[model samples]
Target: MKVFKIVRVLFFISFFSFAQNEDYVKENYNKTETTITMRDGIKLFTVIYAPKDTSKEYPILLQRTPYSCQPYGEDAFRTKIAPNEFLMKEGNIVVYQDVRGRWMSEGVYDNMRAYIPNKKGKQIDEASDTYDSIDWLVKNIPNNNGNVGIWGISYPGFYATYSLLDSHPALKAVSPQASIGDFFFDDFHHNGAYLLSYWRVTPLFGHEKTQPTAKPWFNFPDLGTEDQYQFFLDAGPLSNLDAYYKEDNVFWQQLKDHPNYDDFWKSRGIIQHLKNVKPAVMFVGGFFDAEDLYGPFNSYQAVEKNSSNYNTIVFGPWSHGDWARNSERQSIGNVYFGDSISHTYQKNIETTFFNNFLKNNTQVTVKLPEAYMFDTGLNQWEQYEQWPPKNTEKKSYFLQNNQRLNTHAEKSFTFEEFVSDPKKPVPYSEDIKMVFTPRKYMTDDQRFAARRPDVLVFETPILTEDITMAGPILAKLKVSTTGTDADWVVKVIDVFPSDAADFPETQAYLKMDNYFMMVRSEVMRGRFRNSFSIPEAFIPNEKTAVSIKLQDVNHTFKKGHKIQVQVQSTWFPLIDLNPQTFVPNIFEAKATDFKKQTHRVYNDSSIEFTVLKKK
Candidate 1:
């Protein structure tokens, strides 16, 4: 009865305002702020907006973001328009809700996604809350047409995905934009490998628990947001961290709980349960999206293969958040596409997906699906029927004499050895930013790593013809480790012009840090490579074979350019200081736990990429 009353009151206001279909402005909408009580008595705060001129009820467009919910249509830190463009002009009731345990919302924020599973199955999640939230929104919100949609980027994107598992029937659309589907694959954990630098800096964003309570958290300038001052101050030899740790920092604890791909992570994975998906979905990602590239693609593939759901994917040469709005083309590390690719795409590509599905926008008739790629040189979007074209064939170039990547094999090759000491890891200066710093895996660069002695480089012969590679790149080689634990980093490089005046020669190369993270950063724990669930020690003098899966790449190595792969044992502080000991937790290792490890490259067991070609 209360819901009906709310609907009637809104209908009367909506009917009177429908007299004019004028251009919509920010203030022309009505908003309601509420601390909604869930079925479980959990109070989740939400900000709702409705089109003033609601002739017919509008579909509800919801975004569950931890980034906080501000007034709809107001200038947000994102600076992008909410109610998005298609929603604003086309008009829909937009709702932004803060997840439990963060901001003004109630309940312990589990960082929602990462949780160690219980042997007896005890766990609380965002999906249940999302269901509760949706149940209330559909029944309570006035002028809501039952149809609903949700979307977000990065951390918030994780919420969007979490909401879909046991979704409300009203949720007809959802776009998990650049979300990290598997925490271990990206984010805190990279390919089971630890992303220490990113982890070290992330807790700063969680409310003020990690802050100095005595000193207002706001007063202290944040590292990335403010300047480098805080970063240096926080990590300097004098900083004490216990004063900062908070309950909301579940992600930090999460790293400790799920040491392997056990039930803990398995329970959080929804890609496997993506059956009978009732919503029209849009999985958004950036072609160059470093952190969550695996998420969107992996999720899309799972949805496509696991279930017969209606879905679409849109990817441009973008970063973690760039896909959300129009902005500068380049992100960090001086990585730039030709121009403002985001602006050219913002004319309602994303908003259209939500509007067309949620509001049933008639303006959107035909839609595109599958992975879309934006060619760097061409500066255009191309739709692929599938990733790693089924028609393509595999081409392997072996690591040969010296640093030359060769189709021609070198029969006699000696073993190469280098000491991988975590304590004195490479610094993050010049081109070696990845060596010591943690960046949201997006930008691509190799100039700084091309000359590192620790990194063994291999190059393919100068090509008379162009080679087209459209698939996941893999590094298959004979590998061995002298110590209890070791890390092998591999990178794929696009050998461009060598500062020649002829063509302004410059090409992008994947560094060892990225390669290792992309391919097999999934933790081997060294002791568990033979099995993530089982434990075993490595044979010190044994030569073993390890295949590192380079993150997927789509490229047409143009003429005169070369393809190269670099191998190194340690990515250092960029990744955690892997103490060279295969202990339960390397964090507890002693100073003497560090050891220098050796690796070898051989002709019989050479480094090669499994390529796809037009078979």
Candidate 2:
């Protein structure tokens, strides 16, 4: 039921066949199944795939996942076992396990389970489970060199991060790719606003099974319509959706009860506990990853600040778990980046990372840089000595009159006004199809949004020189609303030149000219403007400062391209519509609480960015 399961299977079937055939995997590898007992006497089902040729001892590469370790029997073999074909063909004792309470593993499953520190005997957490598993692997698994490495994407990636803490001596390397650092900021919610687009995926983790099984026990809700925006709008308030989940869904009920960042959510956060990490860590994520952009960046920063363990980060122009695939051409939505981008990372970055630390006979002399980031605009890779390169300077672009984004603020006080109608919310994308959580919308064109009257668009003139931004973006706004509550959505866009040509991979109905490519965007529920734990209502018609932090960017605004900004109240079904009227819990807000409100953005509003200096 993991969110990445479908994409992983599709990628495995298509790419793995080309890289290494199923017959090759069945011929060279031997599969075995066993259950490892934890300190609490709970058994976790594990599958091990080791090379038949035992001439040389190999390192252990493990992936512990809430998603089931499929092809459960000893006779059945996976198409590709290792992280990539390079590692699979080269040979390693690849391991996959069903994390506690999931699949065939015996225990209770907790979403983003909190790390238990300084534990006594029989204390259980993901870290402890990982420790127990590694201990068992090295002792029982034959031909293992006593060196272990862990890697996973999405939910499994979170487990990889967990393994870093209280790690076994044999665990030398760890790669947490698109890992969830905190559910509050990751998949389910963004800045305290619930992501309604992800509603379809609730059944995956919400429902509990009577017993562990290899097949899915929860069923997805069938909306029976492709138009998600209309479906959510017709469904009305969040409370109405309870008809679908009801009391059977544990996670949905928990979400409704804890609308604020109280003890429940604070304890579940893993970022605060990423201290004294032992394993050599490599944090990987996509710049356009719609689901987990906040997780990897914040987790990496936490590790950098707390631990002295060898750590590095890599950001690519991928969406969600795209780096795990072996596609010849890499593209997100209407734009195509480069060919074999994921393959390059697998061969040069991922393969090199594991082999360097896990293999005793490795000849890898070149260590990865502190940061290996991809520039979306340039469509190229760049290495840095450190993240947010120390040479960067802070710059602010002000929202001016005549829809201009300038270096200076307006001389006089002026504001642009727009009426936000909850009944007619703005759609996040032009596409009308339903999705579990739309990934293409991250880099989707914004022409449809800009044309809307509710959305305010501000753009700077065509840049005479290339300007690159390397760090996080701060959207500091001076705004007010007639109603007591509202949600602020900010977007940073890259406007292509008028004469730009479409690439071969461009969408049939889309063009490259004047494409309003969304570089970054974030939303902040006004109620949580002051403190996440304490809800505050905005004074009607009073100008207040609301600052939203958009995720970090390693993008360059080319010489001919224009830097643009868009501000709006609603992002449609992407995020649940906030009732203009202030209410204690938005989850319980009735339909009558929703109201139309006129919002204003003053000219003094500005966006702050870390501008990388020209060297």
Lowest summed lDDT over 10 consecutive residues: which window, candidate 1? 10-19
Kindly list the per-residue Cα lDDT of model 1 for residues 131-174, writing each as its tens digit.
77888889998878888888777766777776667667888778
The CA lDDT of each predicted structure is 0.57, 0.90
Q: For candidate 1, give the lDDT.
A: 0.57
User: Which predicted model would earn the best TM-score?
Assistant: 2
lDDT of 2 at 123: 91
Model 2 misplaced stretches (Cα beyond 4 Å) = 1-18, 361-364
Residue-wise lDDT of candidate 2 within 370-455, one digit each (tens)? 99999999999989898988889999999887899999886899999899999999999988888867888988999999999999
Question: Each candidate: how many clashes?
Answer: 16, 0
Candidate 2 residue 550 C-alpha distance from true site, Å: 0.6
What C-alpha lDDT does candidate 2 achieve relative to the native structure? Answer: 0.90
Lowest-lDDT window of 10 residues in candidate 2?
9-18
